[model samples]
Target chain A: MRYIATILLFALKYIALKLAFVPLAVILWLCWITAANYRKLSLAKSDVELDKIDQMLAGIKDKLPMDAKIGFRTNIDPGRRGVLYFKSTLILAPRILENNDRDTILLIEDPHLQPVLDKNYECLERGGNQELNYCLMRRRN
Target chain B: MLFFAMLACVLVLFAGTSLSLTKTCGLSGPLRFPVAFALVLVILSYGYYLGLLFQIQIGILLLSLGLPPILYLAFEKYKSRQLNLSFPKKIGSKNLAVLLAILVLTIRFNKYVYRWGDWDAWAIWNLHAKFLFYPEHWRNIFTASLAETHPDYPLMLPSLIALFWRGLGFVTPLVPVAIAHLVLLAIPVTVYLALKRAMHSFAALLSLLIFCVDTTFIHIGGSQYADTLVAFFVLMTFVLYQETKVSSNRRLVFVLGIVAGSTSWIKNEGMLFFLVFSFSFLCFHFKKPAVIFRYILGALIPFIIVIHFKLKLAPANDLIHGGREKDLLSLISDPNRYWLIIKHFTMTGITDYWIMLLLVMIVLINKMPVIRTLPFMAISLVLVGYILVYLTTPHDLDWHLGASVDRLFHHIYPAAVYLFLLKFSENREIRLWS
Candidate 1:
């Protein structure tokens, strides 16, 4: 009877480990796939709209004062506008922009925003292609 | 030099809080690092909150950090007493192997952090760090208009990051990245120490392996999500609460209260965890009013900061939003919501290594003995808290559960392991892994 009980216990352990490994294998696979994709997405900044803002900032950074308060105009959806601010902060050199800071460089992505920005700030310079595009403007002196 | 200065300030405060308690209570040597690190984190969180409130200068920070050790040393001098600061007795070869395994696991976890941190790291925590680093505009992060950042979330993670930046006198992505990775590395070490005390070497090592292998845990820890930090404190509170039951030391009990209470300052769920911890402790030790009171009193230290932040600085929490009654009623009435939550909860929990955890427990069950009361009660209460949060959530049940139920499970995973190992360690039938 003791031998039989040991056999049953061994069986139970085998089954439980077998079941557990199924999910464990799945989790490990899912982790690899998701991690790879996530890395790609994080590094794919050049393909994203944020990269254009970075380029625009790069081209116009030398022209702006070190402490210049910059403005941003973008076509990014309302949900994603924070990303615009975050990525732009990294590329804008010593100058920084908070939301709606008065008398600042307005970096524009959408052409529709260009006229809106043009009305508010003096258009400083416009360059870049549709794929990687931007314009820099400053509030009227 | 400035960076080291800020770090030293944190260490001094940690030593004052933890070394005092550890000395008073005779806590074990293995516990010293986890307790010290957790307390230092609490101090850093407190320092940041105070700095924001006072707009404190560099001199004030230096003074706050320096004064504690000076005062502590003087108090010890007056008493002519020395702390028991020796290391634990030498571990066997197997134990050393486990330590080496955990070190390798942490190194891999750091690489994972390098690859993909949570979306929130870039979008929220680091962004807030930017605001805090720019001392003049730090206040702007709390603006009502910037609703997407969830500014109402407690500032401990961001504030700590910003503190590092303040020392460097500039903000860099590296600041948050490094802080997140430090917290990540601390998690496994925290687990290993807690487990070594509570379980046999093999059981403890096996449990640590479970934690290390769980992709969600490794991912979130690396991602700089506040979840793992919350898990660390929750696990520590559980382990320490178990310690208090055995030793009944007032200072350790008081320190436990502070650690548990500080969880509220980490995340909104931390407040719920703090409540669960307190209620569980009170119920478990109904006759021991003195112990309960000491714990509650210590907790009030961090709880005060949490209340002040919520009431004064933070915007209203997004979870408690407009049309509350209707949302609550709809959530309560829907059977589908219950099914949906259960589905996601199981799927995520299983995928997160619940299956492995259970299988290991079952295999070791014959070798295990009866459980302790406090750890079991604590685990049950925390699990119950997770379900309660999911059931009454004001957000859409699917979206809420999908995004966070797994993380919530992950939060309790360490505590669950500690509880499981505590029970397994008591078995007379099993002495060691061999």
Candidate 2:
């Protein structure tokens, strides 16, 4: 009986110790993965373009009389033409022009306001010219 | 130099208190010095806190300059307390040998503090102290409002550290770390005394040695963590509870309740210990229900004060929130996470080894003739209940449960050591070794 008890105790302890090793392994794996993929995504344009983007955001903020929240999403894709994408939201929509490219159209959603696009030549010409892309919108509701 | 100064002040205040308490009790002889010393230390701790309040430089200096003497007094008081209790004057050679072994193991592996992971100490515990030191940045510690990281850990340890920093003229992160070590060292001493009461001195010493050298225990003790403090209070409550049981001193039981409550104040998991003790006391002392109830109330008073301060008074951002919603099953079933926690806990060095020894001693004692089956059974039941608690904790099976298990082990260590000693000393041969 004593021998059996000793054996059982040892087995239980051994299993306990062996079972405790998993979390450490997982933690180490996480640390390694995070370290490998950690890099700051730098926007690939001159300060002027970056400043222009900030100015655009600021201008949109000023033009919208109502308080419209703005947020930005950035992703890295090696093959994409534009390295950076800026999205802006306004309170209301401006008038649309006929030459708008539906493919790159920044969709504006407002229950109260109709969709409008800048078809003047400068806005369209600037859209495909740079490695940076701007999508503008106004929330109507 | 600042650390030494603070130590000195604490010692002096401790000594003064010890002197006063001994004088009041009219207790004299070889025990006087030690008793006086312990009283002084306890007294001086409060005194130092008072100095911090008034911004008295002299008071601060005195408290800081007096800590060593206070510690010396406490050591003396422990010895004196043993002598008064009719304990053997000298420990037997076998027990001494074990003590030496533990001392050697501890000293040799003391460097593990620098080697072992102290991520929690660095990130949470010390970070709280940093914020407390510069209260202007208190907002940074309340929530991720100032930073993305969570700030919801219990504040007892950090608050104590803050108090020490404010009381002293300087700051060193090591102050709180040192206090943790001090509490760790005190656990064996307290356990030794409690065990001596129920068993032979030699058995008590052997148990102390085993606990001192336990790998996990030593690692936790040395770390800037609250586990050791929690363990100390848990042991204190158990010791006092046992004392009340044997002597029927309701006051001792009341005191035990306060200590039990303080355990909860130290950490959230302390509530588990508090509940276990309350249940144990209620069941054991059911015939005297009113006495038990009063003791429970005494314990709850201090606990409530601490809880009120933490939840209501402390900044809202620092309050741990997401705990209200948790999943229990994941903590037990997740093998990968659970094992990682067990490994770290077991590898805490010599302290873990001691816990293993304690487990063996408990088993051996169960076979002994002198131990009464009832109390032993009761303690075992409580311990099993604690383990079940670990199993049912609403934490992720892998990581959270594992981490909590480590903390829970610490909470019960003192009681475990005391019970092991009590059981081992049942043998006549072991008793004579003292």
Candidate 3:
């Protein structure tokens, strides 16, 4: 009877430990999921910025076609280190509308040209549906 | 430095010739002949540097330490040839290529990562090296200096580092750190090859991959901790045991005895592995009661010598004693703490991978028939033994085990990885590229 009772107690302890594993697994899964989502969101924001640059180039008619997709040469945020999104669309013949800016326009996309854009380029706008969207403009010293 | 390099080159050339000679005699594969040769060369080079710093005669020591194995291999070859027994070089070149790639990757990453971890590496391992490099401060080592906090730790790794410092005349401690990193990389490769010979290639490759990326293993490897070196010797001993068991080669067993002794010399926890291995081997191999007693005595001889040197010549400066009466009393008073220690063993950063593999192995065990019953049983015993160690210990469960989960796990990692891989490979063969 004593041996049986001892065995039963041991079994109960084993079960309790095994039960704790569920919560442990759940917590780990939640952390991994959140990290994955954050990475995806950051990457998507970069892609949107490249799209805006393309739109600005399209709005300004240089010899470059308005439909050209511009890849991001460099990503710069002037005021903050947080994630930012930008979009650009080509307006007809000679105008490029940067989602972040309307007045300061830039040249159309050229395969051979490497354009130097300041972090505070006045024509870059944030166009994503998120609440964090904002436009880039040169800050006066 | 130039002299050391030149000596290393000479050792490598000589070891290479020796390996080729063994290959010609049919001891190992034609493809593995070069790989084995190169590894021996590297080990000799490193060992020579260590031998020089410790004021040991390098040539005589190398010949004494390395020659027995070479001679044994040659004898095996001769015996096999005389008996007309066909020796197959089952190992292939593709596996060697993968190993080389992994080694190169480890080297590149070791160069890039400048940061070391806390606890054993920074506090004990690196600190010891610092003292050894600047020997004028040897007295400071025993003093209550901030650097001598964990003086209870063994000196094998720091001694190696000191040798590198003395031989190369380099001021930066990163030289030894890099060497330790290389050993860490080489260990998994060596263990994998050893496993490949005993089991299947796929099993070996998968085990190696798991070891390399396993968060705990990677963390230890990146730091200056002696755990990786300890695991390396443990695995080497296991491999030697398995090889000798299969071949009935007494000489291999003797070499294994030395390796096991070296494992104990690496750290205090290493003695546990040495004890476990000695007990298991004796029970498994010896049929007669008298022979078993003799076998136990033979194994204990090297262990005794190592312990004597550790206690008499280089006693730990810290307060902890190896065999204190108080330790025994404390253990007898509280047993529940032991079980709590066992519980912590289940917790790990990469628990998900471990769980998935465990589940897969369970399924495989049910499905596979040709998978020998012995390997499964052996692995299960090892896992159970690991858990039981925590439960049976007399130390404060939370304070002792909880504080050093990584170190505790690392000490037994070789056995754990081996057992895990054996179970993982039950139903399927390893597919390297896939």
lDDT tens digits, residues B1-434, model 3?
44365345445444444454344423353323323433343344345434533656534644554565555545656866642222232223445544443544464444333332334554466555555544333323433223224545556666566545555664344554565556666666765766666666776776666665565566666666777777676666655555555654344454456566566666766766666666666656667565345444545645665565556445453334445555655554565655565466656424523633564455555654523543334344545665555544545557656666666556556655665565456546433332
Q: Residues A46-76, candidate 2: write the lDDT tens digits.
A: 1233334444344444443332223222233
Q: Give the per-residue lDDT digits (tens) of candidate 1, residues B1-434.
A: 87778767776676665556566776856667778788888887787768767888865876776687768856875676764334443343434544554455555665666421456775667666666765555766666545556788888888887788888886555566556656765666776777676645666777667766677777777777788888888988877787776785677888888999999988888888898778878887789888888898989999999999889888887777655766687677779877887798778767775743574456365644334466556666777777767778877778888888877876777777666666656654544343
Docking quality level of the chain pair in candidate 1: incorrect
TM-score (chain A only) of candidate 3 = 0.25
For this target, which candidate reaches the highest TM-score against the unseen true structure? 1
For model 1, the local distance difference test gives 0.69
Better of 1 and 2 by DockQ: 1
Question: For model 1, what is the error of residue A130's alpha carbon versus the real structure, in angstroms, after optimal superposition?
Answer: 10
- TM-scores of all predicted structures: 0.78, 0.55, 0.55
lDDT of 1 at B356: 37
Top candidate, metric DockQ:
1
Each candidate: what lDDT? 0.69, 0.49, 0.49
Clashing pairs in 1: none
